[model samples]
Target: MPDALETMKTLIEEINKHNYAYYTLDQPSLTDAEYDALYDKLVQLEAETGTVLPYSPTQRVGGELLKGFEPHRHLARLWSLDKAQNHDDLMAWHTRAQKLVNDYNTQHPDDPLPPLSFVVELKFDGLTLNLTYDRGELVQAATRGNGVVGEGILANVKTIRSVPLRIPYTDGIIEVQGEGIMNLSVLVAYNATAAEPLKNARNAAAGALRNLNPKVTAERKLNAYFYNIGYADSLQFQNHQEMVEFLRDNQFKISPFVKFVDSIDAVEEELEKLVAMRNTLDFLIDGLVVKITDMRTREVLGYTDKFPRWAVAYKFEAEEAVTTLLDVSWNVGRTGKVTPLARVEAVDIGGVTVQNCTLNNMDDIERKNLKFGLGSLVYIRRSNDVIPEILGKVTEEADGSEIVPPAVCPSCGHDLEKKGPHLFCTNKVGCRPQLVGRIAHFASRDAMDIETFSEKTAEQLYDSLDVRDPSDLYYLTFDDLIKLERFGTKKAENLIAAFEKSKQPDLASFLYALGIPNTGKTTTKELAEHYRSLEKLMQAEPEELITLPDIGGIVAESIVGFFRDPAMQRSIERLLAAGIQPVSEEAPAIVDESSPFFGKTVVLTGTLTIMGRDEAAKKLEKLGAKVTGSVSKKTDIVIAGENAGSKLTKAQELGIRIIDNEEELQQLLGDV
Candidate 1:
């Protein structure tokens, strides 16, 4: 009889051989039953021996769920590529690269660099992954997070059969980077039986890679296409083609869309071809990455602060669709600024249903010749996965009826006043939409922390109780709420309790709750931090307001004008008299420079068991921190509560500081 270890090795090698043939080559050497027999034998041998190799197939079966992903620092940085949006931008990039090469050649006439040649490859729309292999063993796998340090998802990555566990190259360590994607066909198959279907392929792949459970990741049946050799200790490729060959030789999936060209014109021609057949591919690609083929040229060109100088991503134009402009509807906002919303015939842009588009005002309408575009075929485009915007009429002739401007406010029947490029409803005191919007904003989680308050509650209060302003909410009696429809005795008590509790608010939230025309949450927080008190902010001048970061001339003017209004001033005084006391950031303890949270920009994501996110934000604010809605480069720290999704993922991608545990957060907030 063969030894246990030797038998296990034989089974592992045989099974892996079949796995490579099946997964990598898209050809199975053995039948399903035959492959299962070998796999089952390997499992049995491993169980009997009570040992499993790091490269064993059984390891991919997945074990216990991980608490959190550990950060893996890559040996080399994964640089981001600069983007060229259009033909003009691409030409500009080419021009800059040629100039830089020319200058370098001029300086080194004796040993000049090779002529500029390029390789264009499809930019896969999926999560970036960096796989590290040492002595033929797949040692680690991580997401290309900040390019420096990423979350290690090795166990999750192992579930991907296409990813080789052991390579032929056993000489040294190598780090390879690629995109992890879920094929469109596989997604369709999975969705047929899935209880909750995935919306898109790109998201499915990314979500799978970021999931804590390896079993969940395995179920996605993801694929990967490696293109770049990020790092190596002993191996090196002279050019892009050579690198592609190396990746292919190692059984790595190389995208077949790679094109090599020596001239800029040839690159442009290839780009045009790619645009034609982009949608035909099984995977998703938003753009094409153009890189200098010669490794020496790339090294000589070096890198900029953010991207490599030798590579630039040529981004395709936003998806466009032609649809008939059915009608134009004018609506009044919380600030009485009336805006036109263009209603279009139902159309699909990049898989999303589009019916509504934005037409800024009279100026935009006239500029785009959209006024005469009513009932006409109009061009609408959705870019960067955002809401679609109208790109004007498709034809020159005014073939349809004109979109007439509103004479009176739709909600209040007041005369519409033209202000610069916009139409304003001067009926602020009587507009139902404006009142309801304002009341909802005031009772929002970020504003007053009014629990159980919704838009329906706001509308009901507006109609029955004649609640005109946000301050009117503070005066709502339990008796008044008890009489309303759907309001039980307990509900009335809870609402009143919420209102009374909201009377004590922080200065920043109180400012945001007012819904200043041009000021956002950031601006409101800045104002609160600088001035510390509501009275001081009310007394702020345009000059003083303009000094803060991101505060432009328009925002400063808006702040001054809002405070100057007698109605707004009177409303603020009414709230103040109603026992609403906004706590100022005047405490010396809050401004402590040594605290980690103080002066940092923070974001809170997911559900918190200890306290509400709004409560956490309030506490962070009191410690001189600014809390925001989204995660960006500017975000200093991220407080990730349980089940944190994309925001947490983005934070990890940016290598932003994350506090995943509530206890860790409690300690930080507790220390302050």
Candidate 2:
């Protein structure tokens, strides 16, 4: 069949040139198992030459499931801009765009209009889209609807892998626009293994491009940028840096954040450095467009019946609101899970006030319709200092009321189970808020550092020395800390010298002070460097703890259910009968490479008071670093402590390298 239609037209132009070099040149010269073996040999030579090319890269995997959306109509008009919100609404939209460029340079002084400059960009948040193309292929996408007709969604914007299926500006028909989004670190890694998580990344990229199922918009792996060519049939430019270098020479995916600037005090100093670099952006802008770099002074400052008087946006100070829900509570944690917590009604939002939010379980309050969101009104948001979530109800008229869920353990009466979409409680050794949150996380400061232990001194040694568990604080003394209740005498010799300096520690800080549930000090330092002891990580074997590299299967079933719990083996035999030993973990530390966090990675974040971020993550894993926990873009040093929050604003939005000096972190843990 003519060499199988020239091997399906050379595997449809080499999988659309490796999906435009992995989504517009992130530069992957093939390897996702060699671009899925040339996209499974062009889907088995288009199912054995039945021939499918309509620019087939297997027609970008989305076809059978539409039945609805069709409208289209946009060859032009998409508009919607005008917003501003402050600095006297951006100096009254920069004094009405400098009096429409001084009345079109006082009635066209010989075809004038040159010096107005402007551009800016950012505004993003997500969903507008548009698309079209025609001669260079794409042919239709839509969604800005009322801006002259929309709907179409060419198979959910061809599952948006940076949206350009073919384009070198093939002579005519254009359109363009953009926005799409959903990349707050890919919605925190798709809500860390989502099972109904999404809760707002601009409504998860506008409900995954208004789904009619392009396989749920290709499982929301969406992304886009483009920046308006809004209808081009035989393109024309005259500015916005020659239309962003012709949408970067038509390979599209543009947003490298163009600036331009001329005045309006350099666009309010680039909108206060884009609201202080939109807290280290992984995408969600919501402010700063500005516009106007010419195009004949944006055609003499045009349009108003719904925006675009030469672009504006600015916005930014809402981080969501609405409020009122007013009640939900639930609580109970130290792993006996239970969660919910809504409360609401106080309000304010992006300037704090909030008053409690997080409704995270009961399948996230029945997937955020907030199972009858308490007295309704709802919505919430406030991402920065996290704890402020809710996101539902605002009159679907469920007329609020159900939230129920608690037949037991509101603090110890036991019984609550559920497990998937969570609830838990199986009172691991009689609760009292899970033994005062496991002895304030086993004397925290990265565990077992003990020093004046607190959670109100583990509820006054669990009410005057009955001290339930963390091996009964090593059978207390100095007459059980000189008879508790605010013990003095140098706080009973500093809580009996921090329980003899946490008796020998080390095996990954005694397996992260045994609060193991899905272990963390980097998976208990890779399970004490792959089971060095505590009897070979209590004789592991979740198929060798999922072959070590940070043991999975729910941390190898929470380390084989915390060492086959005979009540956690009688609290590890009364903390090894009160002596505690630990020690083991040794190998893996040859790295020096002129130190200063040698092979980087790091992370840490907030509260490090001169040491103990588990002793600065064991002196940053003996100076070779790696640390980890969250903040992505494969972190590369973060540290910052003492109230650092949101992983120090996601390491200043992934530009990384933070430190925030504790004497430059003890001169880079120099003599740890």
What is the TM-score of each predicted model, taking all chains together? 0.58, 0.36
lDDT of 1 by residue, 433-489 (tens): 998999999999789868768898999999999998888888888899899997878
Segments of candidate 1 deviating more than 4 angstroms: 322-379, 384-387, 390-672
- After superposition on all CA atoms, how large is the RMSD of candidate 2? 21.1
Give candidate 2's total backbone clashes. Answer: 3
Identify the candidate with maximal TM-score.
1
Q: What is the C-alpha lDDT of each candidate?
A: 0.86, 0.77
Model 2: lDDT equals 0.77
Candidate 2 residue lDDT tens string, 1-672 = 889998788877777877887887788886799888888888887788787877676665667776556667897889887777779877766666676677667877888787767878887877788888888988788888778877888887887877877777788888889888887777778889989877657778888788777877778788888787887868798887888888887778888777888877887887888788786877777677888788877777665457766788887765888978878878787778888788877866432356787877888787767787688798788754357787788777678888888988788777888867788898877888777888788778676766546688888788787888888887888877887665757668777877888888888877788887977787887678656788877877677886544355787987898898888788888898889998875655744658878777777875453344667787787776767677666677788865567888867977888978788788767775
